[model samples]
Target chain A: MLYLGYCRHCGAGLLGLRRCGQGHLLVLCDECDALWQTSDLGQPPQFPPQPDLPCPHCGQSLNGPTAHWASLDEVRQAGWNDALIVGPGGCSAASAT
Target chain B: MRPGRRSVGLTLLGFGVLLAWLVVKPMLPTGPVETGQVRPETPNAGPPASVERPDGAAEQAERPVERPIDSAAGALTELPGDVWRSPGGLLYGPGSREGHRLRHVLRHARDDPDRPGEHGVFDGDQAAIVALIDEAYARSEQGAGRVERDGPRSVVTVDLQRRVGYVGGQVGRRQGHPATRHVRLVLEGRNVITAYPLRP
Candidate 1:
């Protein structure tokens, strides 16, 4: 039940601010070496929009094509599709069903 | 001569005595019990109300209470399966029967939010995946049981116990038996979800 604010990529609790190559302060995760640059310090870094983005350290794909890597984006996409559909089982089921 | 007031008064007095005898008859003892006619013993009554309940029954009655769904969290809680809310505020469970049919899209839907309707795919979070699975399990259970949210694995697991009926083979032609069923569901907030029935 404890929410310790884990890093989404590596499940690590250590998130520190470091300067990226672009001279912007980026959030760095020590466990996976994932970095996120946010425009505002108060706001959380957005989910990476790039597909198949890899981890800087582990070389593992950060945002894969699958839902595992793209969960946040997937949910947001679902919201829009939900509105266009005439009913519940449309959207993804249209292709697979 | 016609009956006088004294005769009427005397008749009334006799009726009163008979009524009194009827009322007192049940409480009064008979002459004596017959030697051959023994009284039957009464069944022992249960213990008094103040007595403590048996530990097994007490524990069984004290199972954890299921919490209501959070309606504001989009379509995650709205799925049709059994739902478990982890202490970390993660909602998870298995997919419902109908939901299971949607596994094709559930497993392969791309996470392209920028393109939106072009992919004909819907984006989802771990909670959404959990909700889809949860909806599938709603028919099997009243609610999710033994929920776990593993941060390291980034997964949610729920264990459930159920009673299922089975038909016997040649020997069971005449009868059916019920067996206790146990199932475990594992979800990594993605398409890597799986469920297996356990030996009870």
Candidate 2:
């Protein structure tokens, strides 16, 4: 699966970007369910990321989740479609790396 | 007239009377009508404000005032169904993308080793959860909650001040976290992204 970044807190779940209704971008961790608002869509969230934000749905602190990587389909189904990787070569690069 | 013609004529007359009665009944006064009653003239009285009864009592006649209907309360009534359109024009149901989002929410319903802390877990079935989401959406639309922009989505939060669910993630259940009284609803344009109980 093409990953934008990894969860800063758990360092396990892959991170991706999702756009809100107003076109603002947010970083989402598929495994831990942590979400963060970001100014840049090109760069994924980095470690020591903003304070421990709660999951918007469950309101749980976004600091947990074991080494479980979410499937690409699950991430896409959850509205995380704005991956940093682009084009046909990007897919191969994501797979190669 | 022939007997058959006479019977038909009678039936038509009866039907006309019944129709007239139906139309006139609503216009008729519900209270007793006063007829042929006279009151003694009092000196310097320009007009009689009330009618005096034979027993020397005065009856005040006035139309009863009607109370205004509360439309908001009427809209908040529990509507039957698993799906509902929020006041803000969002469609929420299992048929929409909300189904996928709900899967993530249901994950917090139990204690999972991978997810820790007191995650707000819902305490009811899918129907009940949908109802809660409907209510929260309504409240948020009425400006009784918070709405924050998240790109192409909006996160709405409402505090119902009553136990709508419980906190029961891995460490939360062991710590005996209290029930949640708030709801967080996320919407993408006119579609519901997800909704779930919020930590108190």
Best model number under TM-score:
2
- In model 1, which regions exceed 4 Å deviation? A1-97, B1-132, B135-144, B152-160, B163-180, B187-200
Indicate the docking level reached by candidate 2. incorrect
Fnat across every predicted model, in order = 0.00, 0.00
Off by over 4 Å in 2: A1-27, A31-97, B1-89, B92-99, B108-114
Tens digits of per-residue lDDT, candidate 2, B1-200, equal 99999999999999999999999999987975433122322222342232322221121211111211112321322123433344444553332111223333334344343233344656664445556777888788789888877455566779998898765555455767667898876566655555667563
Q: How accurate is candidate 2 locally (lDDT)?
A: 0.46
**Which candidate's lDDT is highest?**
2
Residue B197, candidate 1: Cα error in Å is 4.5
Name the Cα RMSD for model 1. 25.0
**lDDT tens per residue, model 1, B64-89:** 12222333332333334544353333
